[model samples]
Target chain A: MNAMPAREQETHILLVEDDPADARLIEIYLEESGFGDWAIDRVQSIHEALDQLAEQDYAIVLLDLTLPDGTGPENIRRIKAEFPDQNVVVLTGFDERVFGLEAVQLGAQDFLVKGDYDENSLAKTLRFSIERQNFIRRLEETQKIARIGSWEFHPDSGRLILSDQVLYLTKPDDNEVKDDVPSAELNQLLRRIHKIALSGREINLDTRIKISGHGERYFHVQCRMTRTSTNQEIVQGILQDVTDRYQTEEMRKARDLARKSTEIREQFIASISHEMRTPMNAIMGLSNVILTGDGVQGEQKQMVQAIRDASDILLGIVNDILDFSAIQAGKIQFREEPFSLRSVCRNLEQILGTKVKDKDLGWKMHIEDQVPDQLIGDKLRMSQILFNLLGNAIKFTEKGQVGLYIELKDRNAEKVELRFRIEDTGIGIPEESQQSIFEDFNRVKYQHKTYEGTGLGLAITRQLVELQQGQIWLESHVGVGTTFYVDLGFAVEPKLTNGHVVNDVLKSSEGAFRGTILVVEDHKMNQLVARKTLERQWPEVQILMAENGQIGLDMLERHHVDLVLMDLQMPVMDGYQATSLIRRHHQARIRQLPVLAMTANAYVSQDPQLHEKGFTDFVLKPFEPEHLFARILQYAPLKAIRL
Target chain B: MSTINTQIDLEYLDSMSGGDTEMRNTLLHMLAEELPKEKDVLAEAAERGDLPAIFQASHSLKSTLAYTGNTEAIRLNEGIEASSRHGLWTAEDQEQLKVLFERMDFLLVALRDLTSE
Candidate 1:
């Protein structure tokens, strides 16, 4: 058959056939097809073909299904099971076309029937088998690199066949499931799929399996079943290790849980604040009434003063706890508005006057010349921070002094960073505990525990300062004293002519407000307090009361009220909705009329868009009479009795 | 425990009231009028497992009793307040409320008598 030679080339071919005539025909066909340089190896039986295949590398094996020693696809399966990438073209009779096609499905590259094609077709099938085998080999090489593997199970033989990659994956475990049989667990899993396959359904499963003597690992497997020509069932599928992806999913779930709990905590704290302040409004409000009531002179007046003091102490504790919780839950909102730094500090000085006197400590507040007249910032929060630091300074100082020094640290045309230094000659924190002093519920142990506080003041102060894009730190000695340094930034605002200082604003109300005022409140005691406090300031000023926003709206329509004091969290339409409605009123003057929102919630001031929420300004409950009066006078300037 | 000190602490009241007898009487009247309603709210909240309500009532009573130096009532209210703060209103909290109610009842009677005098 070697009729021609293509100079210097060698192509080996193995012809596995039992019949002499068939082999000779194949050889003649290949030679006629111009495969002249091919060195063909002829074997009569499957055993001899295997021996020859093991001995040399043949480019293609022309496999005949019928053999003297072996019969059907077993021959093809045995060779492929050993050398999975080996190329084989099945040779069969016309009557055995089905078996030949089955052999191809079992990993043979292509199939051909005797007398079905010419020499050209024979040569084309052979060349195509080699090319297809090379493509499969390269694909398997890539899959192996990506840690993916393939597998097959023959139910008739109860044999599990694994790819090279599958073998490599199990290599780490050194696990051998006894003579190529799957473990009981794996067999049970296969049986389940076998049941599904009975109905011709496919199975896809992602599960974590623990191999004997090996740790747990996750796998994603997709599989289906098919039957051979002999009706023998075979299961084939792919398995991928997905342990890393599984772990990532678990971590993501954990993060979501943490975020959900944080939100719940924030909501809990907000509700608690509301609950606590509602009653505080009653206690403080009634006590103020009793303090101002007639027929209470001498000892009775002193008793009312005591009640007021105790109420103040209780209020302070509640405020501290709420502030700390709010800060911890990241719920503190900050507002930016035009406020004078000088006025804020001076107001703080006056508010802390009684504590300074009670502690018998001298107090000094110094404002640098370079400090801006007005800055756009959360005035209430800025004042709160100063108030907390100064309050603490006063509380700890016994006889020496507490001082606050404010100066411009750095400034630009757009913003200014001011440094607030509050120093006190009082019991100081130790060197080691200084760093952790700002932690929640942490307090330096005093010898006698004489000081009264919730120990949350400093922690809340630090959080508020940080929320404002500022920083706070402290230095202290055990016995000598303590000094806290805070740096905060504020946007510069155009200075208003004759900027109002605390003294001038509080003390210089242009006589009693003589215009009509509307008081919208839900609580009876608070309404009484507002009425009495307003009357105490201006006895002739006409007053109107509304229990809620709905009533408030009705009152505004009927009365010539100059100002509306709106409460935020009231029954049957709250202050926010009422204020919005009022702003949208059909009457231009009524819509433009100022609404001063009065909220028991201190957090209201933290809302950056308070003005947008339809409020001229807001005053917190348990209001200082002077502060409330000033806020009122700002809206309803004093006038001759209503025309 | 036998003689439960239910009387108002004169020293705390003296300091708080600046020794104003009429102010002390006014405070006593307020306490007498409010304490029963506050106690009933706490009891009902505990029975209904309304922890926020229990927490609110306990806090209100605790702040009010702090003015009178009713140590037992204040301590029990603090316990209830703390328990309910975490939304855990249990049988033990109800028992503590009972004890608080007893002590507050005794003090309320004393205050009423003082007001009449």
Candidate 2:
């Protein structure tokens, strides 16, 4: 008997009853139900019963469906609704079996007749119903998480059409939803197969996908090629939606990506190591050799000096990469101070002097007389960019002259414009190379070491110029030389026009563009030529030249311009970005301005869609001066950027 | 009781299983006697395809091999199962299934030697 005392603690009983007298009687039966260590709660209303539920969670709820507070069906619905999480079994005195069926549908775990309530039936129902409900709950949870589960199987027979029959045994009803999902799976599976053959060189792949939401279904996906007397055939590809399994795996993958940043870092390091090592080693080796080549003489000394300077150039190129990365990562530091432009130019010319002399090239620096002697800027950094441009021009030119031409364009009290153009006569860069030359390490392909470089000079120049709120571009033909230009902005004299040098000259004196000027610019040369030419033409009129239709609209924003010059392609924001912006604005400015689309993009310019946009005319370059001037006269009467 | 051949008389069934009429009649008899089915074979054959009927006939033959503890027909039938990827001729697919079937047939010699003992 004492041994029974310990086992008694293991017994658990739940009594749920609503009628005061009947509830007490059930509680009595629960404690006496041949089970020890039983917990019981009794209340007259379902609400009080639910309140007791919060205090002690029962393994089961035995309830009376008929109560003064609620009756047969209402009482059962209330109990089921309030404690849906609890295991519920109905024990009612009235129409017990009738309410039992209704209660079970309402999610009550089981139903018991008043007289039928016994130790055996209650114990069996509690064990079985709880197990079943838990299984159902787990199934729903998985369906909610992965949203998909699938399986892949390779059949022993190699053709799984036979296997599909096996799966049909499990999900016998063949449906069309299954059909669509299978076709998608088959395509995905075939792609995976081709990829594996190319990547891993593995032959077979059986892939499956499972979709979620009711009618939890699964499909078997298979792929194998077979041959007949005449030809090879795709054997079987079946997609059985094994929804239950796919959910778990995809959720796991998402969790993995969320947790692993180091993996991406490692991959990035692996890809860049080969590129970084070669240049770095050269710089390191050359520096070491220079320090040790002290006793070397004559031609050797000259060669060592060449090697040393080359090493410095290499290090500078590497520094450009590091610095650009820093700028991209938002870490570039700028120091602004007043310095002499003459010294900057002198130092840059000195750096390029030897190469110019070696090539027997004559070089000249022409500065506009009115250009400021003292400039406020990062002097060393500005010199570095100018040196890169000059050195590049000198290196590329075998014969004719390379000139560094600096001229003042415009200056306000707060800002100044200095234009630098480097002209070279050498093997000219082709037109296609011109577009991407400013990109890092980009150079004309098969460019021999005759002009040795890290190929970083132009790219770094572009970056620095852009950083200084300046623009840089090059124009060249196949045999003629290339001319590189830069426009730099410096802090102005800060006096506006009141005391600024020659107030009338600073008065935006006689606008450089007048009436209507047709701007024909497909790319660098056309744009620079058009703008500079139009600026020189009127000297005091409005000037508008667009790299693409998009910029044309931008020029339209504040100016009621007299003319539009459009280039079809440059880069993004390209001609399309420009024309579309114009078309959109034209909707607002109907016939207010005339837009002339200038292009080397032969087909896009002819596209019906181009004219449907806001372009009033088209000009092709090398366009005739008379044609451009004629268009200018035609649109000169209208307000520019109107629509 | 026909002595009930504790080993069972599966040789006749196994030998006839390659769509032979005699094997079909014998498989039907085995299903009627020792095996149980909820439906008839003709309806199943009509609803499914010839390959399934053939696989069923082979599967019944496969069971007969198991019951009698025989191995040769099991080898050829397993070979037929593998070779089915390239059709019955086993002419293509790098002849992988045919090779596998041959190896399986070689493995069956062990079963045959044991049954004789």
Candidate 3:
């Protein structure tokens, strides 16, 4: 035989008795029993007993029939009332056996009359009562943990029998459950249960009830008609609380609905932008070709220039709406690269200088001595901010000077902050509308109504500045001047790198390219624009045209092509598949051919790794003459190579 | 005249057994076997003049009749159970109980006959 492992079994007892002798005798008997270890606490009054029980846990209470503060079977009732799960046994006098029996009916586990039993019997009675009470406690715990209760209904007798756990769940503090529930709701529920029972089907339902003190609660109830052993019809049911799970499912549904609506809005913006820009591409591309034509250098030149300028303004307005929608949808991501601050300033000057000169407005730019020539930041976004602000400065100013000042604010080994101040002696903004000017579509109310704008410029500028972790604000009066101050941060690149190449292509009049150019485009107007632009670039260059990528491939087999200007989104074969086939050609010379992607969708060119798609470079639609020429010159050089 | 003047409906039992005649007969035979034992318990409690015990026994028997659609017996047992609960067993309660016992005898004979068929 193996010895069993000894387990620590300690029972705590509370003896509530006013008589000191009886208390001592009870304690001695408990210690002498030798059944288990005991830690007995004695209290003389019911008040003292309750105080001790409140602070500590006891297995059972041996409550005397008489105490200093209370008497009779009432002590057992009181103990049970305070701690409903407490096990209590009444210790009565020998003549009070009738009272002990009454206390047992009330809810006590057992009763023992003093002097009527030996220590062994007394120990046995106490041990049995504790064990029985432990079983009841465990059953109640299981019921509460599962949040479930059982019920039975007899339709013919109109009698309802509820378990103790059901009474605790529905009636709570009250013992009677039948009257606590609302009569109307209970009648409705029973009607449904009866219908289901009569149809020989089990009843399963989700119901909401209002408990007087507990507010609203949800329950999932299931019941079926069952035959008793004596062949009686009874409906037995199990009800469980399902409030938490139901609410969580509802919240998840709401979140998915919100996410779906946002996706639809983004799709609408993308398609609308594409539809509006396709025609504008043809309008601007053809006008640029006509302006660089060799004949009719008089009023025809001015008319073509006006058409080009109008197309430019229309494209700007369309982009404003597209950009605003993208920003609202949180779709813009910034890029990190080393760019020349001087080059950015020079691009802005070239872009806005002609308009200012035509308006006869004085424009000056000043850079502080400590400002770095090349710093690491998002250059495209930075240039957009300057273009919008400078355009506004030239538009609002009549005759006075518009000045741009740049200064370095702070510097560490890691990063530097630069502050830009663009002051214009324009029709200054009024104090009342200055804050409102930054809101979308809010144009300043001025006496001169000739100024035309989409009024989204300042709003987009503020979002762009904040995206770069910068702040922008303006200070102005009604008539004096308006000065916009912007603070932006940039990481200092120690090793100097050449910034974005300042395109001096407009100054180069060398029509210098000698190669066969293949233009693959599906749209006829786009083909005409590309052919005319390439013909003007190199007067002596031979250009071949294809309606799609298949034709382009067939043309490539027959003709020795030097460069392929590919258009994405075609009829039979799209640019991606065509580029993949071209790169996988058997001959190395054809596989290495430079393919430039031309797209009306400006968003495509934003990706820096367009070269990975077999594209040597990318150009936006509505191509500027100089930008198109500059790209061609880079890939297909002049006949007289500058070695 | 027949001693068993009443007929009990066994539609609930038939449907519960999915119209299987053999299963229904088995259920009817079980009911026939159990009713005599429940009747003895009711009669013993009535003889002892324990109204509470009489009430409990009748309460259980009332539901048994309700399932088999023994409507008259259900009415009689309900009266006895209610009177006993109020501690007032009048002549009306005794009369209903006598009729209820007779109905129980009829139910047992009826169920036995169905099983035999």
Best by DockQ: 1
Writing each residue's lDDT as its tens digit, candidate 1 over A1-643 gives 2222223466678888878888889878987998557877788888887787777788888889998888789889877766566788888898999989779767888899998978999888887877777887887788666767787778776666666565554443654322333555555665676667656788788876666566666778788888878888888877777777888888898988888887767666655565555545545655565566564677777766777777778777877877776776667777666765765565566567767887778888888988876788878788778888888887777779999998999999899999999999998877988888888877777776746777788888899899888999998998899999999999996643212222223322334677888888765445655786777657787889997889999989988888789877565777888988988889976786768888766577566445666687787776666567656654443342232
Clashing pairs in 1: A299-B20, A299-B21, A300-B20, A300-B21, A300-B22, A300-B23, A302-B17, A303-B17, A306-B16, A306-B17
Better of 1 and 2 by DockQ: 1
Tell me each candidate's TM-score: 0.66, 0.34, 0.57
TM-score of chain A of 2: 0.39
Q: Grade the docking of candidate 3.
A: incorrect
Error of model 2, residue B97, in angstroms = 65
Residue A415 error for model 2, in Å? 2.0
**Model 1: which docking level applies?**
incorrect
Error of 1 at A332 (Å): 4.3
Best by TM-score: 1
Question: Candidate 2 at residue A386, lDDT?
Answer: 84
Alpha-carbon local distance difference test for all models: 0.73, 0.52, 0.73
Point out the worst 10-residue segment of candidate 3 chain A by lDDT: A497-506
Q: Taking the candidates in order, what DockQ does each have?
A: 0.08, 0.00, 0.00
Candidate 2: segments with Cα more than 4 A from true spot = A1-106, A109-299, A302-306, A309-313, A446-451, A492-643, B1-117
